[model samples]
Target: MEADEKIEKISSQTLISNSPSKRIRIRPLTKASLVLRGTLVVLVLLTAYTFYTIDVKDVNFVQGMIGTAKNVKVMFLEPHLSHFSFSHALYQVMITLGLAFLTTVFGAIIAVFLSLFAAQNLSSKRVSVVIKGFAAFIRAVPTVLWVLIFAVAAGLGSVAAVIGMTFHSISYLIKAYSESFEELDKGVIEALQASGASWWQIVFQAVIPSSISYMISWTFMRFEINFAVAVAMGAAAGAGGIGFDMFMASSFYYDIREIGAVTYFILVIAILLEVLATQIKKRLKVNI
Candidate 1:
């Protein structure tokens, strides 16, 4: 009874004390948020205006939609290769896979070293900032644009594709790897330093081992991205792969069935790559 009376008296006193205080106020939107909202509003208005002013030339919407449905049906349901044999398609797929693999391997190798400078814990602030800034610039450029840029020097072929893809991959993996390295416990690094361990020794013994799993995960993810990019490069840069076949089928032959077949092949390979990555992670006891 005493405890309950005490609680009631304290609650009443708190309420009475709080009664004269200002009510809790909600925060106003920040400048960044207001800017974002304004940008969105502008984009919406522009989109609406563009659509309102757009002209359609001699096309019936219902007929167009029906034709699209038919094309989709033919592409997906009745998919079969017309010009190329299954073996040829498979070989082209292997070429694309090779490009992806080569770029990934090269990028991983280079990024591992570059990331040492990019990681704040491992490098000085100026070095990290410079490296990260360069990487950001590289990443800002589209992979296709890079390929085209390099194509001027390397000429239109696998060489340009590989160089461009690897360049982008290196930038991407550097960011990923540096972030992973930064996630390392500071105590462990400090302990290594106190033990009179050399920088190289500490990196090899502690850093690499601790972050190997993350490195593997990022590498595989980049490989997957490179694979998709390689496909586009095949057509765009004349790199010559299944993507070229896909382009030819779609544009020149207008063979939806062939396009569909190539699509299925790519899809199957993607699934297999995912499964392989999962298995490797499991084998290595990598949780991530």
Candidate 2:
């Protein structure tokens, strides 16, 4: 009788425990949710105020659109091949390509070293912090300011553009490369270290080979940014490039067709880089 009574008591407790009303209730909105909602409201109001204060109505939107369309049409109708001969447009393209290439290469090389110092796991905390701070400082300054500084220091030319792009490239490359390094499989490094491999050997034999795809992706992305910056720097520094040509064309209100042509060329270059980089990433992914 006592055993039957205990069994009945256990059965009743289980039924009650399994009931829906006995389950713990969770609140819909958390503290984080409320904070995010408040932040979004503030951002929306700020954006509205900013738009209201900016005299966008004073701008000739319709005329500008018509002018741009006409210029684009003229560019397509005109012989870009002929313009390549005397206009130095081709030379400017070459200069921009050369500067971007050199800056990316040199900056990537320097970035590899800097990234080692900046990586928290790879270096002392103080060294990593210092390197990160330096990278941030470099990134904080505008590329245009760097161009002007170098232009005055180097006496106005492609050289200044090259230096400015290189500085900016270092900041980007270091951050990207270090993050890539951090994401690497730590097990491989640990295994290599366990087998009596030196730090340099482990890095070269394991880390770099594994991170090649990410490095390539980042480098190509930086190449696109560097190319755009190089063109802008060329214009600012009065260096010979499409940017300079475009600036001159704009200043004199010359054939808008020429300006359009330069813009088109830049677009083509950017598209090409993006396509090529995509292909590279695919190939790397497949190979891996």
Backbone clashes per model, in order?
0, 0
Q: Write the per-residue lDDT of candidate 2 for residues 1-288, one digit (tens) a residue.
A: 999999999999888878966666586778999999999999999999997887866668798899878776786667243334444776788788877899999899999988977877667899988988889998999877887788888978877877887898999899998888888877887888899999888778887788888898999999888888878866788766777777776566566666667777788888888899889999999997
Q: On residues 1-288, what C-alpha lDDT tens digit does candidate 1 reach at each position?
A: 999999999999999888888676597779998999999999999999998987878888799999999999999999998999999999999999999999999999999999998999999999999999999999999999999999999999989999999999999999999999999999999999999999888889999899999899899999999999999998999898999999999989999999999999999999999999999888778353
The numbered model that scores best in TM-score is: 1
lDDT over C-alpha atoms for residue 204 of model 1: 90
* Full-model lDDT, candidate 1: 0.94
Clashes of 1: 0
lDDT by candidate, in order shown: 0.94, 0.82
Candidate 1's displacement at residue 200, Å, is 0.8
Candidate 2 Cα errors over 4 Å, as ranges: 1-87
TM-score of each: 0.86, 0.75
